[model samples]
Target: MIPPAFRDPVHDSQSAFRRLLKALSRPGTPVSLTGPAQPPAPMGGPLAAIALTLADADCPIWLDPALSTEPVRRYLHFHTNAPQIADPKAAAIALIGDAGRLPGLNEFHPGEAAYPDRSTTLILQLPALTGGPSVRLSGPGIETTASLAPRGLPGWFWQAWHENAARYPLGVDIFLTDDRIVIGLPRSTKVEAP
Candidate 1:
């Protein structure tokens, strides 16, 4: 169902991008990513915001086996010319589903020692995210400190992140979106168990 808000003529795409940028620059800091009243079918405004901020012709995105078909594929193609690659190995951006289906950190491209920044970014749309185990993080862009309520992501996710962070600049960045909200976790942010 389309929300009433999208009808406004002033629905600005720039705002959505700015929010995403702040979050990317400051990992672990939750930012509210708003978008045009309605996004393409299936994917919500938040996910749409992510696509708008990140995807482009230069970026090769991998649509999950689930979303590789029509409308979603066409919508992304029309909106952002990001080519959809068949293999995750060659993809710069991976739009995935079912966090459980994601491969271990060692599996995806973690970039190389010379150009760790070459690693692919995985934009995984998950089932849901809520008060996760309380964990505090403090880093470059963070002020004194910050904490998340506690997410239900499985232990495997954390394990992978730990290993990924170990790779330093080589690790892939993750942008997680539920429906209306999107959260970013750059490689630099340290996640701890409370």
Candidate 2:
């Protein structure tokens, strides 16, 4: 059987949602998730916690092949009851297990002109939050600039991110996570090589 979800679903989900909001408001800053539910393999603490907090019956999810295992699927289904869709464009949130094999940013829905907020949000599982090549972040929420070094991403990630950012309101938001740490990179955040 799948492991139990948040001990206090109401309180835990509220707290987790607040943390995510803070992270997104302060791009590149780390946010720690607090909870007791340990998700199945390939789904780390932060990702699992995020799924529990944000996903629901209305939020359809798309899983990268590596994280599309039965256990992971079952766990999310049991806890969130969110539908898992095959088409990335139809997903409200996309969970990526291997950053190197991640699809292009434009491959997912960027939302339409009338409703840019409908774009998909990406949650990528990374090896670590630091010790890789740093990227300079600018734009909304940042006072001047911020630096981040999310390890395990492909070399072309920043270039792709640059392109994604150029789309202005029509772009996907990203959340990068290690085991327990989560860093947000909203569509408004600009990324550059440092």
Against the true structure, whose TM-score is highest? 2
Off by over 4 Å in 2: none
Report the Cα lDDT for residue 73, model 2. 95
Which stretches in model 1 have alpha-carbon errors above 4 Å? 1-11, 149-152
Tens-digit lDDT track for model 1 on 1-194?
Answer: 22332333234556766787787787766677775556555666777667756788998887766666586777777767788888787778887655556666565677888988778887766666565566666566777666754344555887678767777877888877776667777777666665
Count of clashing residue pairs in every prediction: 6, 0
Residue-level lDDT tens digits of model 2 in 5-116: 7888898889989999999999999999764556788788788888888899999999999899999999999888999999999999999999889988877999999999
Worst 10 residues of 2 by lDDT: 33-42
lDDT of the structure predicted as candidate 1? 0.69
Top candidate on lDDT is 2
After superposition on all CA atoms, how large is the RMSD of candidate 2?
0.9
TM-score of 2: 0.97
TM-score of each: 0.82, 0.97
